[model samples]
Target chain A: MVESSPPTRLDALLDQLATDLEPVKPLDDRPTALVLAGLFAAAVALVLAWLGPRPGLLGEDVQPMFMLRSGTLAVLAVVCVAAVVAQAHPGVGRNSQGWKVAAAMAALFPLVGAVVAFTDPAHARAMMMMPTGWQCLRMSLMTGTLCAVPMVLHLRRGAPVAPERAGLLVGLASGSLGALAYNLHCPFDSVVYIGLWYGVAIAVAAVAGRLVVPRLIRW
Target chain B: MTSDEATLARLMRESQGGNAQAYRQLLGLAAPLLQRWFRRKVAPHELDDLVQDTLLAVHQRRASWDPARPFLPWLAAIARYRWVDRLRRSALRNHDALFDDISVESGESALIGRLGCDRLLALLPAGQAAAIRAMKIDGLSVTEAAAQLGQSESMVKVNVHRGLKKLAAMVDEDA
Candidate 1:
């Protein structure tokens, strides 16, 4: 056999890095997704049992619209989670498409809300701002903070090429899940409140993620 | 897809399992490829250093590797990152200080008097090779080289740096 090239300082560095190396148990995305889903479910259940769904949600006329709003929020949560997982692996193409899809969905909610509020003319201003706006924002943020813990932990297991992007996705995921949970407790069925407050909550989490992820995930 | 790649993947998998021997063997196997890759981007004297940096990065970040994915793309991404880092650092180096260190006879004009550069030039990427030919071998200024190549002056500087680095690697390899 041909002799290998003479060893260099790289050999030493490699040895140093590999010393006391333990086998890494591979992190699968499926389990992470399940855990996030379970956490979101638990949060929603707790909120429902404690405060109950919006008072008028049981009525026939309001129930369908409430279900529709909650369903949209749930879909947003799932998409954000998928984006977060996709960004965890290095060398995987940047999940721009996933981000774009999430953004479109996010944008769609607000645009639809604006149209509905303006057309009604009766409650447009009232729908735009509410006394409970601050509460909704707080609840969403609280939910996001709780959910971000697991999301960040899962992200730490992988080599992310873009930490900021990964963080933003994590924030979006957690924030949306938080909004979904908040939706269970929020009695206001007005599209304006849901669109504006929920959007801001997600944005806050995303900005926080962008700032925190690079530092948190750096190897 | 190739057997070489398959073998490399196997070695990486073994290395991830805390196999030092396999890890060492993997680094050894990676050296020449890393050398060639760095050569196309940096100078000869810097080649070994960049290669070492890449190796260290690979070692430190090895845990992030997914066994399900092919190994080379992951390694390439790390190498590319290191290359960009080196370029950024080089750009920050004091140019006047660098110029003062070179002897008059070792300037581009004198260096172009030699004929052996063609063989080495052939080994570089097209953009870098052309940049070197116009700026170094032909003794054109950066502006002239940029105009001749229809590229930005900064781009010409980058190409020249990368080409010279590759030529230095060839000399070192031959030596």
Candidate 2:
């Protein structure tokens, strides 16, 4: 049987579209860097305006554990931003090593906290449920919300093949940024408090991203 | 990747930057693949419509393509979505016709039925009518209709709801 030539309509449509086509501006080569900078800047501004940085952030009394907490959150934020950018275009990061790296970083803080808590058995229970855990959760979510708007706008500019995945990355990135910002103000030096409360806030942000991204970026 | 894939990717990137020639070339290259893809599932006559629909979707969503990624996968995903949407609409059209046939047979004269259908559709603005046709008569999901119409999903849903409500009001007045 003669296969009819592929329809001419495609040719006509292409011709029509070509006639109206406008030159597209070049995409930013490092949108992830730009977005990360934006998120950090937003978070820092919020920190300075509302809750000043931790009193001892630069003082000699600053604990070593505080660095670990903030450092881990920063790593998560950076890795998640990379993954989100990778996913902004579907099929770009099929291997998705970035996500695995982000996940490992996310796990590290909690695992280290658990180990430290075990070493100090008497204070373990109290540190596990800090009195200000809710405050951390709220502040982290607020920070995530602040960062999410700009991140989502950036992601929307790209063609994300998987809206859910794209949104998830946005949420994770935003949540991490939020936690990083909250860390500046959070006084609790206990690893357990940082691990549990910051984790909750990031999870909430991730879930929110999953729910909201698909709708916002559908083009 | 093959040279063709690399060329396609370059074309897509260039197209994104407003090179009309590259955009045309990219679509030209994509058309055959889309035709083959759609032909596997749909009738021969419906082939052009599906191909056109997929191309339109790609045009609208082109900004989402990442320059670093292979272009074929992005194009393939859009084609696949449009094909599945066609299958869904085909199924719904059949199902709706079964019920619509009963109503047409029961009371309305054939001429009146035709007039009523045309008149009701005409009552709506072009955008609303197109939305109603795709969503109501054609059985497309709101997302599917939105993509086809180049409108947001919410806008499609709103148009369909409002168009149908108005049609119902008109029927009541006629009665």
For model 1, the DockQ equals 0.17
Per-residue error (Å), model 1, residue A93 = 4.0
My TM-score estimates for the predictions, one after another, are 0.72, 0.67
Error of 1 at B151 (Å): 12
lDDT, model 1, position B88? 45
Candidate 1 structure quality by residue, lDDT tens digits, A75-100? 77788788777555555232245556
For candidate 1, the per-residue lDDT at A6 reads: 70
Model 2: residue B21 alpha-carbon error in angstroms: 3.9
TM-score of chain B of each: 0.58, 0.52
lDDT of 2 by residue, B45-124 (tens): 56689888888988876876767767766675555446545644553453222122111223324323322345546767
**Reference-based lDDT, residue A105, model 2:** 71
DockQ (C-alpha) of model 2? 0.17
